[model samples]
Target: MSTKLHSAVEVGHLRKVRRLLTADGANLVNAGDGLAEETPLHLAARLGKADIAEILLDSGADPQLRCRCPFVNKFDMNNGRGDALHIAAAFGHASVIEVLLAACEPQAPDADGYFRLLDLTAMYGHVEALNLLLERCPMDVSVRSQALCFALEHAQIECARALISSGVDVTTPRRLYRPDGKGIRPLQFALSPYSDPCDDHILKTEEEALELVKLLVEAGADVNANATIAHRFGRYDGCDEVSILSCAAHYKLLKAANFLLASGADLNAKDEKGWTALHVAVASGNPENVRLFLDAGASHQVTWNICTVLDNDNYKFTKKWTALDVIGMCDTRILDLRVSLDWKKYTLIGDYTEVIELLVEDGADIEAKHETRYVGNTLLHSACSIANLSAPAGFKRSEFENGIICMNTTIQRLLPTVAAFVKAGANPNCLNRFHETPLHVLLSGVMNAIETVSGSYKYHHAYNWVEEEEKPSIQLLFQCICRTVRVLASAGADLN
Candidate 1:
């Protein structure tokens, strides 16, 4: 009898449904079918047969009755059970949803009930259903957050896009927690998604994703809003409490970075750690991203600013860092630049070759004095300091080899930068606060390496090189260093 009633409703046979719902079939109005164990009303709602739905509702259909069908969801957030309203929204049955809401009239769903409908609608990407729910159902900011995040995480771009123009703040994260104990966010995920879209079988094309971002900003998503959650996919580097713009730069999402800057994201807005978007771009070693930030009017001298950091032994000190300083600091790890110097203090390293070129081209403060933590170190001094800080004056076959390659490339670049600085009426021989000149710093490093080579200076690590392979590599490395010093000498450094 129940099977016949459900078939009648599924076929939209009003007369058959009415005939079955007579005194004999009245009890069958809420009977579960053998297939899905869903009541006749659930079938009507799922099929969007409003006429049939109204009959079921008028007879004895329970709008709040749950079906025992297993849900085919990836996350299983909704435990495989749904009511008529849930079934209607999941399939975008706007007309049938109206009937279900009418059936439940005079008793609007409580907060939890309203969101169940909204969540189901959003989860399935039914814009019409979502629109109707957003209209008839009242949602606070928290509800809006949950709805938007659910839409985003499920890759339901249309539903997520529709929710934006409905006055929901796009900057908010979902109230629901993921396995990581962190809530998913719209902008944060757009910048750095936790999983590939294909991992969930939701193919969100790049163009489609960009369109969603456009809708977000068009609806007043804060371009400078600090991310509620920092979802990182690559190397974990830098502080986590980063703004969206900084995160874009860190991930080298050039399109995102470009769009954010075009949308008027604050280029110099400092993150909690006081690193600007450009600072992150420089650290990420993406020359194009670095160029993007600078073209968007990132402060050429912002990296020259000092940030507070702790030193070894827990002493506090202020360090002046620059894009010039952070270049050549990447290896092995992903976008991570803050290398641990034996876990005492933090220093940045990345292969920022083209980034360095862009900075130089942007008229960076080549003669800037506040380039490093040491007092009054000029750009030249800090350039040498980075070489010393990373490689040090060591005499190991491999360490010395890596150190020379790094230092040689850096000073070689700085040599031309020095000429440009001198042409701009800046002094290459400018004295640091220690009264030591840039040339003095370079010479000290060369002397240390030479002394360590002759076994005069204290050095560790045995040279595991065969004599034949050692001599030529060492000679070539010195040639690279010599060529750089020769350029500095020609650039009017006080050779005396």
Candidate 2:
């Protein structure tokens, strides 16, 4: 073969190459002029030319010559050693594979001490060629097989099964495990989490993935066993100790959860969140799992809020009970009590007329304080904040001072609850334990509004009210000063 014939043979132009070879009287063994150092047979095999490869092999071409191209790039055009069998296996040509395997160096190990043919077949997911190599080839199966590279990575189940049944030990001491505190096995690799963030191949859905888990479990694999390979792969970098039961629960595998649980997995055992499996069930919103936890004798604790209150409440109280009853009469939630003192605070803030009517219908405490600190402000305190606290002009006062505090006023026309608070005997003057009066709060509100208007502070620009023309409704500071003087005169507030 001439130097140019190498390119012709590589492209499977056997007829043209033969004519040139015959014309030049050059033998098939001649090397290419290029740095390939490849024979006509090497070129044919590299291009996967089976017929041309046979002709070159018969024409006294040496099959043992390794091509200049790497093993991964080589193709089999003719039956040749090193190169020919690898190409046949790469393309999954079983007949060509058999011919090359018969002629090639079966015992020869590549640079990796693994046969290139087995690796090629495994990469292609070729079950037949993989089985033939594992069962019959003189090549060492103990040496890592190429089947594992793709078999473990892509999860070629059929090829893996064939390799396993052909007596390739599923727990073989291959390159799968690392030297950790304890020896990890190949079985663990099948169950381990993916190392790559982009690799979703660990298991796509709960079902397809669980089948592998179940198979390994059936093969007497440890369900709760923590393999050392996790440490080797850096998978558990930030993870605490996680076992099979924990993994199953984390994966939300109910069947796996049931298996792990039934096998005496800790149903109440907490993960990093201190959350039990019951919490997981509830978070998943799976009612069936909720029933499972309940059946497992899990107790449902009553949350503080009524919105999230479970039917599992041990104290059979009505939903319409008071805040005092909910907190077991403890005075700790006094701020919550203040916020919930009236219907306005607890209920949605809306139209004063409707809110007042609704609270009146609910039989809310008209003059009751939520706690000792919240004295004098009933739901009326909250209603007054919205300009809704109303009372008859002749109504007497036992909750605060004498009949000087009039509840009914056309103040409802002034922005609902804030005006209502003043009308309802909520002394904008009532000092908390901190001695901060409501005027202090109102003053802060005024300053915040000014800052917001001037853009000196960031404000929620969504609902900004730019003054088209400053309306003279008694200035806020003057009104507050006047209200303070009137409150001191009426109720004798200690301004000093």
Candidate 3:
């Protein structure tokens, strides 16, 4: 057995190596090839040859022999500090894993100081093999495994279920948030049961994911639980920062949204920003959600300004919506009351029909105008003003110049509202304090840009940093000229 046994074992010719060892029926345990620790059992275990392993064990080979100075001793590789169990586990041979676990002494530390059986099994997704190790090995199940994390990341549901059932606290806190803190919990990872939407990784099917979500929710996991713990752990994404209900709202999951709401989730709860659930629904442009929130008593007047909540934020935004200026057609007292009551929390549902009916029932003065202080422009004016037109004077010239907001492109900004007002009988030709009509007020001057504090541009919290030109509203002037031309043409007024 000069070197024939060692070379045959090296090449995995286990039967040949064993034959050479037992040629004279020598005890496999004591059979060594010149090397200090080159035992026949070591060869079989090193190569993960279960057949050879069984043969050597039956032939009186000592299973617990430590191979001292038998192989490469590269200092870089932790001084070659590995054993037969390490080799077998690394190769993922169930039979070899079983043999090593059985032959090793009870609580005997592997050369690495811990036998990570589940870890190895999770890594390879060897379910059957893991089951064997779980049954036979006295390994600690509490050790955090890269394999477990990988299984979750890849969404191997079967493997994850097994690990979870085997006493893995899914919400174990891990340190990822503060520098010296205990860490974040595990349930956070369960927040988004799907893989990266931007990536093409098919982590889980929709049905499978829904089932998982249902199971997690049923198992005392808060369906509306704040998943910010994951965000604290650096999983920075939309899903990580919101509760399940918020996520459903963001993704337009109507059923999920309703379920969360019915389950007593706070609809008015603000997120990291001061945005309530109703705010999100409107910003999402989903009319269904718009109606849902309104019916659920969500405030329509609250607006987000610079990510901060705004009071009395009234605006009905639709492709063909009559702007809030229509509220001017409503009773001033009612408007005052709505402003005072923080009506931003309520949204207009179903054409504001209910709102209109309620106002009618309250005997509201529908024709009341903000002629002096509030500048009551009507619904039609608001609508056309959004198209960049001006409100008609509807008063005398001096009053138009002072009260009509003719300067600073006020007329242009109020164009849609002006048109809405005309459509609602605010009088397109109503004289201002000056003798100029609505069309006359529009033709006053050219426009640059206006300075505004809490209007449409700033309502959504956008920053408009461009410097304003001192010029007046030219668009209004152009509209006025066009209107004059159209009037002269239509009324048979002769051009000089």
Candidate 4:
């Protein structure tokens, strides 16, 4: 065919294309076997020329011809890739896709080949084209599930719904990824704060997120199914087995959390840490979420795992913390719950005064202190051991200054937290096995507490080796530590 014939198709000159096809006849229309050789019909399909594509197909342009394009990954790479179907689906030309489907001689290729074509349409989020493919090329459950995975991997929600409606079982214990990659299951993904790296489309509204969660549950998805976490963080950090309700709480997906609760989800389910949804919600520090779980019958009596970061970085003491202790030990907005690893919450500290007050008012044990089952040390004595802080903050034992944080950065919230604990009637004079009072822990963290303690202890929390003259930050840390000491004294912290 002449350039004018191709040009007419390019500019959508339908009549001119008709005259050219008959004028030149079928011999020149295809011109070659593979469109990689630039067959006229393939170009028309690729350009979304639906009318022209029909004309070519009618004029004996081979729809079944394989595209010999060197970009095999685009069209020919898959097992049973269709030439024109692949091109038209990629550009999302539903009309053209329909035309080619009807013209397909041996019918659409087997499931595997069709799925490769689906990848193009699904990734581009072409819903209509996807529906057309599904109808023309029926897939078995395995293929349908693979197609659903493709849709979700791209956040193609509309396509995913279509696949689910087409019977892609959501209950098969699906896991998306692991430590080596971004991983989570279907229901967990919908309720998670983390988005898959490949997702271009994501859940938009609270209603949408909640709806998907509900949809998955209705489709035989088990809320209590235990999926190995893709990558551990948040409430499920150290736990490999967990419930969907706990996941909702961890991400603060309040709508989903409420929906799950209404749908018979186990509200107070405990995993390896003896943590319930209430504990996850508390650790998340969203008071509204905390209240939600609490109102829904989640327990305040549950013990949650918490790390008390001391001035030292070596002695990481994991203790059974009540919701109240979580307020003291970490931030409300949990950015990283590397609890299984560093447990560094790496957060911008916020005032927990109101929330702590709320928890205490709600009967959260303000005095829910205890020695670690193994360590047998109270929060203070366990906190200030020189052996634990001896390292150069390698274990991040003290989250207060994990290289990303500095001592002065947390001073404002620090004072309020101490006041909240003291006001809640938590005993500062309570002794750990070491027989030291909480005042000793405070003095041990900062060498001196506001210069008000009857006398200074021999040991100090601040690094004395770093010269205050060389760095202004070191001097600022000293000032903050002194202020922290003052707050403890004003709050009536007792020396043992």
Top-scoring candidate (TM-score): 4
Name the runs in model 1 displaced over 4 angstroms. Answer: 1-27, 33-37, 68-79, 105-115, 135-206, 230-240, 250-253, 282-287, 299-496
lDDT of candidate 4 vs native? 0.58
Output the TM-score of candidate 3: 0.40
Question: Which ten contiguous residues of candidate 3 have the minimum total lDDT?
Answer: 333-342
For model 2, the superposed segments whose C-alpha errors exceed 4 Å read: 1-48, 60-84, 107-109, 112-116, 138-150, 172-184, 192-208, 218-220, 230-496
Candidates in order, TM-scores: namely 0.54, 0.42, 0.40, 0.62
lDDT scores in order? 0.59, 0.43, 0.43, 0.58
Query: With candidate 4 superimposed using the best TM-score fit, by how many Å does residue 303's alpha carbon deviate from the native?
Result: 2.8
Clashes (N, CA, C under 3 Å) per candidate: 5, 23, 53, 4
lDDT value, residue 241 of candidate 1: 53
Per-residue lDDT of model 1, residues 260-297, tens digit only: 88898887887554667787777655778888878777
Clashes of 4: 4
- TM-score preference between candidates 3 and 4, better one: 4
User: Against the true structure, whose lDDT is highest?
Assistant: 1
lDDT for model 1 comes to 0.59
Q: Per-residue lDDT of 1-496 in model 3, one digit per residue for the tens?
A: 5356556656778668668767844643556665445566666655667776776566666665555422222123333333555445445567776766666643343454543545545544557666665566545544533334444544555655666666555544444334544342333333233333333334544444444444444444555455442321133331223444544444444555665577676777655444555544543334455456566766544433221122346543322111122332211211111111111212221133333333333333334332222334333222223222222221112221221222333333243334333433344444434443444434332231222212322332232332233123344445644653464334343333
Model 4 TM-score relative to the real fold = 0.62
Candidate 1 worst ten-residue window by lDDT = 338-347
